[model samples]
Target chain A: MEMTGLFFYLVSVLIAGGIYAVLCLALNVQWGMGGLFNAGIAGFFAVGAYASAIVTTAASDKHLGGFGLPIPLGLAAAMIVAGVTGWVVAKICVRLKSDYLAMASVGIAEILRLVIVNESWLTNGSLGISGVPRPFADLVQGRSADLVYLAVVWFCVLLVYILCQRLYVSPWGRTLRAIRDNEDSARAAGKDVDWFRLQTFVIGCALMGLAGGLSAHYFKFLSPSATEPLLVTFLVWVMLMAGGSGNNRGAIVGALAIWFIWSATEIFTSRLPPEWITRSSYIRMLLVGLLLQFVLQKFRSGLMPEKSPKIRSD
Target chain B: MIDFINLYLVPGLAIGSVYALGAVGISMIFGILRFAHFAHGDLMTIGGYGVLTAVWFIPVNPLLLLPFGIALAIVSALLVDQFFYKPLRKLPTIYTVIASFGVALIFRSVAQLFWSSGNQVFTSGVRMPMVLFDTFRISELHMQVIILTVIIAIALHFFLTRSKLGRAMRAVSDEPELAAVAGLDTERVVRWTWVIGASLAATAGVFAGMDTSMHPNLGWNLLLAMFAAAVLGGIGKPMGAIAGGFIIGIAEETVTYTWFSDEAFISPSYKSAVAFFIMVALLLFRPQGLFKGRLL
Candidate 1:
């Protein structure tokens, strides 16, 4: 590949990595801080992507889109949709115990994907919706669009990271940890456990949705295939678990590392012998699975355990 | 309406029986182990492949293959338990769950590596369709599924309710620590539970293979439905899982009749989504499931 082409690929991959990192951070807030085992992050992510795509794209007789709102407004709408969906799912499922809640969330995610796939009248069905304009595309020309988009995504990621770090050290974070450690005790101590969980889940899902919206605009396409369970959901779980689920910084680091490995492997696989290349895809999947299992076995605390906030008695 | 019921409902029940068998195994394992064993689906796939392999070599009658297939499935289950589950016994439930997911991915890769991803059909000379009177007709495969399901259900019911080992297994499920303190061999019970559950799952796979074409992804594809059934029936309750499986199967099949054309547009590809929808609805409205009193 040419230098510029390689540069574009690398930057694009980094942008994708940033988007996924945002998602991992969102999941960390839900699973690590709040102890909610949400397996349906992809559903909310997809909802955000579709919400933004529909809102910003020009409406035609064939399909409906919001009246050509600006990208930021569309993204805001996406977050709202995703957050509300998360809240509804949380209200229904958080009342259940751990395993059941996981199952329920996964089920909902699958259903959401199906609806996106089957509701052709609404989502354009499996044919997918395209021609989405990138944010600030008018200002950035041609090859520079990729770099500009990367900058935009990184900006959002940094903002979210700082906000999350603040939350992690606040009183709310203390209450979240208390609920995670012992929900019954938290409730007994006058903490509204369900409300806190719901809050965390919705906020996390909203962030995930915003990440999705960002990606959708960057890619300039929306499809049900983008939200497959194995690719989106399990991949995010792998990132979260691998990165140290409780640590926001770790989540971002893990996302970048995994995406780099994944991209590098994909690029390398094609250059090898055809049969070897064919075999390598399966090997790659197996390696990922084994890596996850190994990580869980050895470093159950993940790569970076979140530091406990220091306490000073007055 | 009566004719439609006869045409659809009876066949639905037969298909549902297959799902029930698989669901029972899933529920039993969850009850005992307290984790969603993702490998359970792949184990079923292994059983189907096992039966196919045996039939390929032996040229035996399909009827005879049942016992052989069940035996092979039992052995496969035992091997998986020994190699995978045994080492992870000391780990947390989530660790085991993730390990099972890995094991499942490994099994899938192995299947892809060895068998190729193409679908395989194992046909025997026994292609006769069973007829229920002149008007009602069913496949021999469907008949086998019904008979096997009933036999397994009766046998398991007897074993759980009337046998000492079965009672011990129940004790362990109810309270593992208490059962251990009460001098019940908890390890032994867990082993037997795996044996029974694995064997039943394999049997379901073999029967399902006979009815439909066997493929690498068949069991994994059926997982959502199996999970829906298990959860709908109450996670730990074997009978509930069975009933939940049947309910899901029949409901999905019946939905085809109501929305046949629209369903066609939706593509039976979304069939898994139907099961997931049912599971989510059940979770939202009745998380404890139909038969269970409360969450464990």
Candidate 2:
């Protein structure tokens, strides 16, 4: 491969990996630290992507997204939209048992997908919205633009990672974990478990929304097809599990590793002889299942097991 | 009126029967195992494909293939339980949920690998729509669906309420530890639960495939409906599941027809959304459902 080609290819992978890193971090915050399970990761991701795309893209007669707002404001609107959805879902499902929350989340994700598919005026139906603007697109073109996008996405990932790292170490973080560990005891300590869970859920969803917005802007496209529940929800979960949750750095490693494995498998599958094509995809699924089972049994704690809780002298 | 009867009522009954069979399986497993068996949908797929295999050999009749498909599905259900659920029985509920998700992917992949994507239909000598009274018509397969579901649901009701093994299964679902202490063979109960639930699932899949065409993802689409029906009637109650099934079935058909104002507001794609909305509304207002089975 040419040097420039290689650079672009590598930068593209990094850009994709960085967006996933943000998603993984959001999941870590929800599942790892807050003990909130959001099975509808794709739904939240789609919400943010569409939200940003709608706000930033030029106005069309058929559908929404005519505002042509700035990218930052678009991203902020994405966060608010995703956060509010999370808040409503949390209010409905979080107060009850945890399992209900998981099932409800799945329902919510499917509902969102249905809306995107059926609601023509909002999402342009199946065709989806296009021409999502990128930051600094005017200044740089081609490969340079990609590099800039990579830097921007990674910067966002790093920003979120640092924010999560700081939040999890604070007293508020300790309280969230406490609520997760034992709601009764947390309540005994005067912690409002419901309120804390709601806040953490919104924060996690906002991060996920931000990841989606960045991903949409980078790709310059948004569609219902890209957000399959199994591909988005289950894959993110397996990544989190393999990378180990709770810790932000480990989550990033997990995201990159799984994303690479997925991409590698796709490339490998594409190159297979014509005869073996149908079986190859199935084999891929089998391999993923086997890989997950092996990972679960052998390294249940994941590659980077969560660090032992730090002693607090306070 | 004819259109409403044919379009809404008859189809509702047919679809409701399928959902009833599926919901019964889901409720039984949930009661006995105490986790959402996300793999149940894929199990239905296996049963559907299993029927396809049976029909290939004995094209004499599709109903004749039912027993064969049920047999294959029973073995698979046993194997899945022995392999996955047995190991994680004592662990946290979440492990089983995630593990089931993995298993679901595996089943779907295998089905897709074998059958690929297009729909597969069963060939019979002649399909005649049975007309009841004057203007009411239902297909033979649909009639068979309604009759078969009623028979199975009744048999299941009797088996769960009257039979010794059925009582043992209920006992185990109620309290495994206590049942064991009381000298009920817990292993036997678990095995029977798997057999019964899986058999019902296979039957449902076979008929659903008969009504429509069989595909790898057919059961996956129906999974949420089964969940809604199962949870709607209250989990663990077979009778309630049947009731929930019919309710969901009629509601799905009715919603398809009923739209806001003049235009088709709901659209065809919102069918699952409607089912999900019902499930959510139930969860919010009446989590215990109509019959009030155990709520986890």
Candidate 3:
């Protein structure tokens, strides 16, 4: 029984890690390949999560949805909704400098959060939506159900990873890298910098939406807490930076490694005295933050540094 | 008229003072360092908590211990710069921006570790408003906040325009490469930037605490508004930030006032959006800002 319990814990960690991998890949598409700094992964994630929750969950008068759609449809809806939202934001902000874009995106995310909280009819407010369905929940039960979900999560990660990998080497991806590396030169070369950036932003945000939908199904519940920027935005950033920015494999590796560190720290923090129980989370956060500083200073390119294809001198 | 003066205008200006104080720091840092400095708001958190901790020891009026808080914030900002930011100065500004996010987390966590996450107030219960001319009523705290901000603004203006270091700072912001060519002490200006920025942020934090309650998220919750004010005033312009702050603060407060009927013009919960709206509109229409600040 203890072995099974331990196994389940490991499975859950992997599930969460897989979701983060998808998010990292999404981010890699933007910040890594496109050189677009999207500081509001949480906002896009929230949009996707609530969209999926409302679509997949059984009829409830409390919130907006009674769709009772299939899990696949819910996931598709998540991507589409998030992609459209990203398109709108990209139209406005993609032309700005990286720093300005970051600030603008943060503002948009905050506004989205406020909307989630204030517009209770749509999101059920802070109360959140429950009974969110998993992909194969009716078929599998108990530990096996978790194993199935784990497989599903990893499958999504694999799909996103493959997508990102392909995009990294594709001509389109090369153009993006050109735009990111030297916008003036790229523009001089007849590239539509703004349009390329807009496309990259939308794609990245859509992937973040997929991750959010996966997490919603995994948790079987959705709440405002799920969209917390500390976890959704900053942590994903740390993962990408720690693993590697431009490399697709680095995104996956960074996601799992950082997720492990994040989860393992909880074990140590849980052992703190009763008074420190409430403060343990903060300590964990401090540790993660310090780790980022250390990583940034020491490993500028991250663990799996980007190795761009070199042009032959011959 | 009295109700508008007492209820909307006074509170708006008071809150505007807080935003202006914080925005000045953000603007200066952006102008000089060329990064958004995501952690500026967290620096304000350090100030409020600093005062809170000091009050525990002295048990005086919170305002009396404000300097200590300011000093604490300055020290913290300087340390952060020395340790985290100074090394990244050579890299792309994105590195520093990302590092600032991490630093923000660290500051908030430190506050949470030391003070706990719950809300803390300097004094219990509310103070009565002072009645002026037997018609208009205003909170003593609000009056003090506005007056102190005005004084600070005048001092800041003089310091920026008159003081040697202040002029040097502006020079660095305008053209760092040129400033260095002109033999200005860029490092010293950077250090002083942190000092001025941190002190003002701390003052804003304490004032914000006085206006409401101090929690771990106090400064963070107001971060959007401060950034909006900074951008609205034009990036890198301190005086512009102050004006932008007041405009945003007043708009935020007055927008919710019941002008036509009993219902608010907008939901109180969405007041934060007002700053965001103003910022986006400004970005769309006039990226150089009202003051014709730096385009970058």
Q: Can you give the DockQ of every candidate in the order shown?
A: 0.52, 0.61, 0.82
**What is the iRMS for every candidate structure?**
2.4, 1.6, 1.0
lDDT of 3 by residue, B173-243 (tens): 98989999999989999999999999999999999998888898898888889999999998889999999
Fill in the DockQ of model 1.
Answer: 0.52
DockQ of 3: 0.82
lDDT of 2 at B119: 85
User: Compared with the true structure, what per-residue lDDT tens digits does model 2 show for residues B1-296?
Assistant: 68767977889889899899998988888888888888888888898888898778776667777878788889988987888778877776767777787788888888888887678888744677878887778887888899988998889889988999999888887787899999998888888888888888888888888888899888877888888999899988888999999899988887767456654446767877777888888888998888988878
Between prediction 1 and prediction 3, the one with superior TM-score is: 3
Worst 10 contiguous positions by lDDT, candidate 1 chain B: B258-267
Model 2 lDDT tens row, A263-296? 7787778888987876887788777776776666
* Clash statistics: count for each candidate: 0, 1, 0
| TM-score, A chain, model 3 | 0.96
Q: Which regions in candidate 3 have their CA more than 4 angstroms from the true location?
A: A310-314
| lDDT at B109, model 3 | 95
Ranked by lDDT from best down, the candidates are: 3, 2, 1
Q: What is the Cα-based lDDT of residue B135 in candidate 3?
A: 92
lDDT measured at residue B250 in model 1 versus the true structure, 0 to 100: 83
Query: Share of real interface contacts recovered by each model?
Result: 0.48, 0.47, 0.82
What does candidate 1's lDDT look like per residue over A1-314, in tens digits? 59989999899899999999999989989987988877677888988888888888887444566457888888998899999988887887787666666666667777788788788877898878887879788897998888998999999999889978888889998899999887889999999998898999999999988988998898888888765455566677788888888899988988888888888999999899987886887788778777776676676677787788888899
